[model samples]
Each structure stands twice: as C-alpha cells, then as structure tokens.
Target: MTNTDVTQLDNPLWYALKGAQQAYAIGSSHIRRYRSGILPFAAYDYRSPGNIAELDSFLEKDEVFFLVGALPSLPSHWKLIRELPCAQMTLELPPAPLQTTTAVTALTAADRDTMFELIHRVQPGYYEPDTHQLGNYFGIWQDDKLVAIAGERMRLEGMVEISAVCTDPAYTGRGYAQQLIVHICRTNLEKGNMLFLHVLTSNERAIRLYEHLGFRQRRVISFWKLINAGTILGTKL
Candidate 1:
C-alpha cells in the first residue's frame, strides 16, 4: 500500500481522461470528458480560454455536467449550479482478508434492471442506466433479489474507483455493504490497481466505515455541478 503522488490523487478526472480510460474520453488537447451516459466527469489542465472553449464544445446547450477537482475559470455561458465538498479517499489494496461471502456474484446485463432499481432507490443521481457499461460490478443476492452492490468507475493508469456502493433499506445493519466493498477491493488489488472513491463530506457514517477498512482521506475536492447557460431558454453557446 503505497501513496500516490498528490497531483495524481488531486486531479483524478484529468488523469483518467488522459490515461487508461482515454478511449472513452471526448475532448480536445486541453480538455476531455467521458461520453454522455457513461460518466458526467470532465476536466482540464488549466483555466485557459482555449481549454474552457474545448470543454464547452463537448456539451449540448443547457446540458448539465459535473467537474471534479480544482474549479476552473468559467466562461459566462457556463453556469455553476452547485458545488459539493467531497472527500477523495484512497486504500492500498489486499485489504485484511475479509470473511468471504459466497453469495456475492458478478453482475451482468441480465441483472441490469435490478441493479438500477437498487441504486436508484438507495443512491441515485450519479449513476445512469448505462453506467454499468463503464466497468465491472458485483452484488450480493438474497432470495434472488439484489440487496447490496459495489463496483468500479473512473479508471486511471494504476487506480480504479470503487463506486455505486449501496444496500437495500431492509438489509442495512447486516454488513452487506462492507462485504461487497471488500470483494471489489480484493478483486481490483489482484489486478494491480489501487482503489479510490469519493464520498460527500457530510457522509460521516460512510467515512467511518471506509476508515475502518483502512482507507485514508487523501484530499478534499469540489464536485461542481454546472449547467450549460446556452441551453437556458433555448439559447445557443
């Protein structure tokens, strides 16, 4: 479990756009973003006019997108809707051996609807119907029902994000989330990628659980939700 360079940990979206998941990115030399329906993250090297222009070009008029890391200088046509303070946490893998849960299964397209239902019901907004296309997901089942899930998102050269972790309300106190997270962590660690994730700064309970699992907070980043001003009243950028 080694520490990542501060630059790499601080600007994860930029690195992901420029590294392992570059194939999924859409932007010019200065800015890049994942295609719509995959992930809403976009990033740039600096707050230059050219970089800002390039990022604007990737959005449809009025479409909303999210920017993580340093907030860049924005053109008037881009409006900042909200900014969330988020904690970027990282864990060096091969975590202390978790009690293996045999019922945890690798999820596939056939389980897509159930996955969406569980995620939307518990933790919605960030996940889309097709987000499963971005990476592998795993879940725990109870009587054939998807009760808990944890999966990958945001890939960079040597790191993979563990995201979309959730559990059904009926199953909260049973340690299902912890089991699924350990499963995903062990899997990615075996593949040689360190694990990282973002949680709202206000989510203390989740933070405690992550810390108990050996994850440490690397930095705090702003999750900026922006709306394309050009789309307002059908205006054009």
Candidate 2:
C-alpha cells in the first residue's frame, strides 16, 4: 500500500488502539491505552475536553503513560512529565543486503526468560515480558546464549512494526543486530507487509545504521509522558 492509502500511518497509536492490537487496549469511547504491561502508549481521538477527561480517568496516581502523535490539550488533573522527541521511520520491503554471517534462529516460549534478561540488561523500560505476543522474534546466539534480537511489534492490516532491536552490551559490534534486522525486513516484505519503526531522535548511531539499511525518516513524533497531578513525591509506576 502507498503512503496515502494507509491512513493509520498518520496517527499510528490511535489506529493501533482501534486495530489489530486492540485486544490489549482499555478505555472508553474517546480515549484508549494499551494495558500497562503491554505498552506505555495511549491515544485519544484528538484534542477535546471529553477525550482528555476520558484519558485522565484511566490513569492512576503517579502512573505515567505516553501520548503519541500530535500534542493534545490535557486535562488539569494530568501533569506533563516529559516530552520525548522521536523519529518515525519506515522502510520499503527488501532492504539492501547486509552480510549474514551469524546464524539467526527463531525464538520461542522457551527463550522468554533469557530474552527478558537480555532486553532488561540492554534496552530496558520499553519491552514487556509478553511483548513476544506481538509477532515473531529472531535471535543470534553466541555459544548457546542469546546475544541479540529483533522482532515485530505493532501491526495493522497492511503494516507491521519492527521493534525491540537490541544486543547485549558485550555482543555489540559483531554485526548481529544488522543481520537480524535484514532478516526480519526481508521476511516481512515477502509476506507483503510494509515495515516501520520508531527511535529516539537523539540516537544518531541507530539512525545512521537504519538509514544505511534503506529505512527513511518519515516524521518527528512527540511522546508526551504524562503523570497524574495527584501523584505523591516518591510514588513510582
């Protein structure tokens, strides 16, 4: 599908709340969010009083969640904790070839514990224990240890997000990440799905690697992290 054909690309989180990943969503008519363990993202129809009120009702004291897409007018009970600027990137199928030296293996339930450990040690805070439910994951093992991984995350009818790409700190610079990304890209393209992903704007190293692999920066998205105004000084999420 062409860019114009996929309206969901314009407001990805909102559409995801209403699309394939909707099973994980919780909210009323105007607002919706993925369950806490699934993702920290939430989205509303747009900037409106009713939508803001509905969103506030779903948040707990001291709990934080991200509002992705265009900035919205928030309710008084919600506090703007932080604004993270991110780059929304998309790639056409079959990214340029990369040397596939390492053996990439499909991961399964048996690998969950080790996967979580590697993710927590390297790319923490975002990946959930059950994130594997989103789609297939592939890993590069070094001496029987999972040293790197890349996988699919969000999915709409015609597109799938390539996310949770990380490598153990000790395993970096080995070309594991690059190979796995290329594998996932080629697999998704063969399945006829467009690929997209998000990365922090400040991560220039990752940006360079993705661009070199044929992914292009689409837009700058704002991740507005909001906390309940009633939160106490030391409470945690």
Candidate 3:
C-alpha cells in the first residue's frame, strides 16, 4: 500500500503489531516513550488517526516521533525537517552458512549474564534494561564464555526480527556474527517464520556482511527521531 493510504485500518504497523507479539515486546520501549509523556514526532501506523493540528499541539512540547509501516503525508501546516534513508533487510532460510560453525543453541539462564556482558562489550549502548528483560536470548559459546548472540525481538504474523546481534571485540575477525545470524535465521525458519532486520544506511560493512550471508535489501526506511525537549546534546539514546 502507498504511504498516503496509511490512515486505513489495515496499515502494516497495525497488522504487524496485532499479528506479532514479539514486535510489540521489542517495541514496548518506544510505545512507553509516548505513554511516559515523551511526544513522538514521528508517529505512524494510522490505526489511531490524528490530524496535524493534533500533532502540532504535541510537537511544540517534544517531537520524538517514529515512522512505521509507510510514510504519511504531513499536514500543510507542518514543514519539512531532516530525512535520511534507512534500510531493511530480509534473509530466507534455512540460513545456509557461507562458512560453518557449530549448531546454534538456546542460551541457558546461566548464560544470560555473560551474554549481556559480551553484547555490551561490543555495543555498550545496546540493551536498555527494558530490552534485556524482553525475550529468550540465544548465544554461541566458546568454552565457557559467550562469543556471540542473536535472538528474537519483533514478531508479526509469520515473521520474526533477529536482533541484539553482537560479537566480542577480541573475536571480531572470526565471523561469529555471520555464524550467529545464520543459526538464528535457520532456527526461526524451522519454526516457519521469515527473518527481517533494520540497519543504518551508514553501516556499509554490516550491510555487506548481511548481503554476503544471503540477505537482500527489502526497502529503504526513514528513521526520524524527534528531539526530546529536555535531552542534552550528545546524550545517549
């Protein structure tokens, strides 16, 4: 469907949210932002329609918005702001590896702390306390230490998002991310769902790695974050 038709009840975001509890689970942080009085500058989904005047009222206070499903037409009163093209990638299964590694295994409860530390070491900004508590996490262990991890985030109908992918810094060149991605996607495929993920346009290396591992670019998306009024410059997200 075109972006203009997003106001319809069948908008992708609505169906996606309704169909995928995992998506809702992963995105709960975002939804909570609006619920907690952080005005979303980029609200989409059209499941609950509101006019620009309605948005403008909130816009002046804080403009932390999200654009989901398809882009919507702005009201005449609103002016253009910054726009950047992001990308979504999808990989079909059984995620055949370009290289091989041991079978992916479900992370045990004991593995959680080490898994968190490994991910945080590579990507400290990841794993808000909320995301950490969200779902079952999976990992690849070398000896007793967790080397890499990938797991469920969002779910919609027959699809699941593979997220929280990270590798230990010292282990970067070993293709752990690739192995974990294949293992995760294959695991999801066995359960009869497709895999999809989002990455920044500037992350060329990651995009290339995903492509090499059989993922293809599905579409370009715009990630518009509205600046929260009280947020200090250079503050972490």
Candidate 4:
C-alpha cells in the first residue's frame, strides 16, 4: 500500500471522525469530536467563527480537549492552555527483522486496567480510560505483568495511527516497545494499512528509537489544548 497519502493526515481527527471512527464522533459536518473520555480530541472542517462557537457548545463548562492540527483563532470563552508540538512520523514499508524476547500477547477487556496502569505510569495525559476500545492493543508481559504496549488509533481509509507505544520505566531499553511496534506495522501492512505516529518534539530518545525502527519524520504538528473556561478555577484534564 502507498503511504504517500497526505490528504487525511492534515486533519486526521476530522477525517477519522467523519470516516471509519464516526461511530464515536459527536457534532456536525462543520465540526466533530470524539465522545468525551474515549479521546479528548476535536476538529473542524472550516476555520469559521460559527464553527468555533459550535465546538464550544459541545464541551462541558470546564471541559478540556485538543484540536489536533494548526491552532485557530478562538473566542474569549475558550482558553488556550498549552500547545504540544509533535513530530508526525510514518513507516511505509515493513520493519527490519525483529526478534523479540517476550511473547506479544493480545490485550482485551480483561487486561484494560493493567494496560491503563502501565501506559499512565510511563507516559500520562495522552491515553484515556476507554481509548483501548478504539483499536487492537498488544503488550509484552514479564512475570505476568504488562510491561509494554503499542496499538492503533485514528483509522483512515488506508492509513492507521500507531499510538500509546510505551514501556514500564524498569523495562526501558529491553526492546519491548520496538517489538510491539514491529508487530503493529507488520500486521497492519498485511491488511493494506500504512502506519503513522506522533512523538513530542522534545522527546529525542523516543525519536531515535522510532527512527531506528524505520519510522521517518513526516512533519511537525501540534496538539492544541483548549478549554471552555466557564470558570477561572477549572481543573486540568
């Protein structure tokens, strides 16, 4: 499959919400968002003030979520909290020979709590409580514990996002994440899906690991964190 398709990547949330993942979407053609808790993300087809107002109404008074692309002009009711710039990377071809140590186990509802614990322990703020249901997840187990995990998110027509790739701090450098990534890419490739992912620009170690695993930086994108500040003392999400 050709991974050169950049049309959907520009506004992945919009395309995903309007396409394969529409079942979890809320809002209209002008603006769309994932249902709360599954993924705190929203997108707009057009950058109009009307669309912005429509988006604001979809949020709770003190709700926090992200616009996964270039930031747009906002009304005073909406507040810009933080901007997370990320290197959007892609891997077109199959990964090099990957010989993993631990067996890769398919994760399920029974393992949801453990998966949440491990992902949040290593990296927080991205993965949500019910995000696991969005796609298939696989993990590496050590002594019956899930030490590492990687899985799909934001499915387009021919593209899929590889997300939540993390390892238990103690299990770092054990090639567990690399193993899971290869498995995801290889499996998706067989299904005619090209793989992509995003990493924080400040995370050089992770960038290097992804590069080593055949992922090339496609572009830099920002996840704009915004809030419907009904009150000044709203809590962080």
Candidate 5:
C-alpha cells in the first residue's frame, strides 16, 4: 500500500480539530480540546507551559482530558492519572467482506443510554456521554439487548479513527465485536476515508483481530490521561 501523508497520524487529535472536526473544537488556535461531553481530547502545535496554561483556560476545576503521543509533565495543577500507550493501526486496503450472519442496525437516539453503558462497561474513560453524536454508530441486537457496537471518533480531513468497539462479556467469542468492526472499516473505506484504530498494546486479542481484518500497526501513541487539580500554589489551575 502507498503511504499518503500519514504524518498527520502522528498527532491525529490536533489535526482533527484543526481540520474536519473543527466544529467540535474549543480553545485557542495553538492548543484546543473538543467541546465538553463530546470527547475529552486536547492537542497543541507544540508542548510548552504556555500551551498548557492555554488548555487550562478551556477546562473547569476537577475536569479531565486526554493528550496523545508524549505525556507532558504536569505543573501541580494537573495530576497525571495514567499513561495509556496504544498501538496505532491503519487499514489501507479494504477488510474482508462484512459477515452478514447477524444484523447490525444503526444505533439511534433511543439507544444512547444503552450504548453509553455498554461502551463504558467494556472500555471506560476514552468515551464521553455524548460521543455518539460524533459519528455513525452501529450495533447488534440479540436477545432483545444491544450486545455489540463499533463507531468512529477523532476525525481528520481524510481519516477516521475507529473506536468504541466493544461487546458485552456474556456475548464474547461469538464474533459480535468482529462483525461490527468489519462493518465499520468497510463502511468508512467505501467513503474514501483512511481508517485507523487505537487498541492498548496490552490488548493482544483486539490487536490480532484488527490485524486479521487487514489493519497494520503503524505506530504507538502514548495517550496521557490527566485531570485538573483546580488550583495550586495560589495560582488558578
């Protein structure tokens, strides 16, 4: 496959807010985060105390947010929660034909609570309450319950990150998550957008699944999770 300016992938969140996902952006030109309750992601043109302070301006006391790539050293007002290093994989070629054995329906407004609960249950912290509004999400209903789901997040001009791919524990090993993933990858590729996903490097099972579906490991981005400490040293945090 030909490499076509995947440099933007190096700092996907920042470029995303600067490009296609600008409407969801907040903060100054150099440093920014997504609108509250959309996605708790922030990016900057460069890392510096000034940028950190600028980002601080966009958040409230006790707020939380994420920064991918290198985890910056916090200045008392911000506390390091966890450094989640992830394997960044990309799909240049189309995935295997979507297995249609199970019906994957487009999740609607009615399914928001169910979707939120399931995603947070399986993969908490990355997703926000209103994250479903960011992109088209699909699900598989079994036994009158939403068992599996996969959807988009952190969008750039011509790229989309596949996220929230999860399934109920009782529904594992039946390929429910796999089906939703294939459907999402295929659907996004058909729209001419480059596809990529971030799975924790420790999640060998999920990584293998994506690889089997034709996603190759492009790099590893260390996503730093941080929380606002309100104020410290008598300075507004």
Candidate 6:
C-alpha cells in the first residue's frame, strides 16, 4: 500500500471554510452581483468596501442565510452569531491494532437520500444552500443504516474540504467518527489534495478528537452573516 504523507497538507483550516457559500437569488440586485463576483476561494478579499453591504443585503432578502468564512469583529448591535471551529487533520493512519471493526466503504448514489437525512438528524439545521454542486460526500453504513460519514464540500484546484461529518448520536462513544476521518484524509492524500474543515472553538470535545487523530490547531477566524445595513465602519477581527 502507498503510504500517506500528512506533512504536505495545507496548514490553515480556514482555507476550506472560505468556499462554503452558494449562490442565492433572494438578495438585492447589487448584493447578488457582489456575492456572485466574490471569489469563493479567496477568503481575504472580503475586506473590500461594500462587502458588508452585500452580505447584509443578502441576509435581509431572506429571513435566514448562510455565510461561511472568517468574520470580522463588529459592534454589539449585531447578534453573536454561531461560531464554527476550524481544524486541519492530517492523513496519518494509526496502528491497525486499534481499529477492530467492520469495514467501511464509499457512499453510492443509492445512499444520497438516506445519507443527507442522517446528516441533518445528527447536525440539525445544517444544509447546503447548493446541493447540486456538493462535492464528494461519503459515508459508512451498517446493515443498511448509515452510521458515520465525512466527505468533501467546497473544492478548489489544489484543495478539497472535509465537511458534513456526523455520526449517530446513539453511537457517539464509538470510534466511528475517527474511522470516517481516516478514510477521508487517506482518500484526499491519495488524490494529491489536502484536507481542511471548520468547527466551533467552544467545542472542546471535537477539538480533542481532532488533535488525537493527528489534526493540528489552526488560527481562529470570526464567522459572520450580516443583514440590512450591517457594515463595519472601520475594523478587522
């Protein structure tokens, strides 16, 4: 078997988080234009003037919207949005002695419906605004029920993101999540792509798991979703 190289992976976990957005038509014409023109792969370019206006307009157009990327620190007038912790896990296979379970496999077209349902069940309110463009989502099933899953979402030329990871809450204590992560990183490394993901900084449990599984801590980024006239006058997070 070809050995995986974890050292060559991308350093910052936020890189994958940059592309979580998908096009939506509910925003103002200008907002839609700006969001469409925004580069999904470049996370830094969002600091430009009117970027906040664009996002705020986008949010006001709809009751709720999804914004993924580093959020800038703003004033107290804005609500404290949910925080997603970002992490980068390397592809280093642990000793085989530790894994003594049934084999895991890639997901198939037949698994899409059930897989998505299972994901929502585990991580409620998590939905891809653009499912048509969803990348390589994978899963492991047991006796026809999807148990654990981890796979790609936003992808650029040299990078692929690992996201939508969810295991049945009832099966939490098991190593199912670790197994799925191992499979994900191995596949990405083999394909010459690096793996990255975002999680809430407050989620100590997940942070511990990633660190134990060979993932390193990366820089923190503020994630935001502004609506109406929610522009930052002058600041950076």
lDDT of 1: 0.82
lDDT of 6 by residue, 1-237 (tens): 234333323322222333233242233322331133122221223435244343342333223333444454433434644555444443333413346575777776666677767877887555433332456666667767878887776554455667777898767777878777777777777677656666777778987877776666645544444332343333322
Task: Give the count of colliding residue pairs in each prediction.
Answer: 0, 0, 10, 0, 0, 7
Where is model 5 poorest over a 10-residue stretch in terms of lDDT? Answer: 45-54
RMSD, every candidate, angstroms = 2.7, 3.4, 7.4, 3.3, 2.3, 7.0
Please provide, for model 3 over 1-237, each residue's C-alpha lDDT reduced to its tens digit, 9 standing for 90 to 100: 112222222233344444434333223322212222211323443534443234443344344455454545555434445555667787742455465656566876566567667766776533443443334567767776777887765555666667788877766788778877877777666776667777778889999988877788877766554334432232322
lDDT at residue 187 of model 5 (Cα atoms): 80
Q: What overall lDDT goes with each candidate model?
A: 0.82, 0.80, 0.56, 0.84, 0.84, 0.52
Instruction: Please give the lDDT score at residue 28 for candidate 6.
Output: 33
- Clash count in backbone of candidate 3: 10
Global Cα lDDT for candidate 2: 0.80
Worst 10 residues of 4 by lDDT: 228-237
Candidate 2 residue 85 C-alpha distance from true site, Å: 0.9
Q: How much lDDT does candidate 3 score?
A: 0.56
| Per-model TM-score versus the true fold | 0.90, 0.89, 0.65, 0.92, 0.92, 0.66
- Write candidate 2's Cα lDDT for 59-122 as tens digits: 7786777788777666666789888888989994357776566789999988888888898789
> Which prediction has more favorable TM-score, 4 or 6?
4
| lDDT by residue (tens digit), candidate 5, 1-237 | 223468899888888888878888997777888999898888887545355667777877888888888655556778889889899999855777754689989997788899999999988987888898888899999999999999998788778888999899999999988888888877877777788999999999889888988999999889998888887434664
lDDT tens string, model 1, 73-129?
Answer: 777788899999988998843567666655788999898888889998898778877
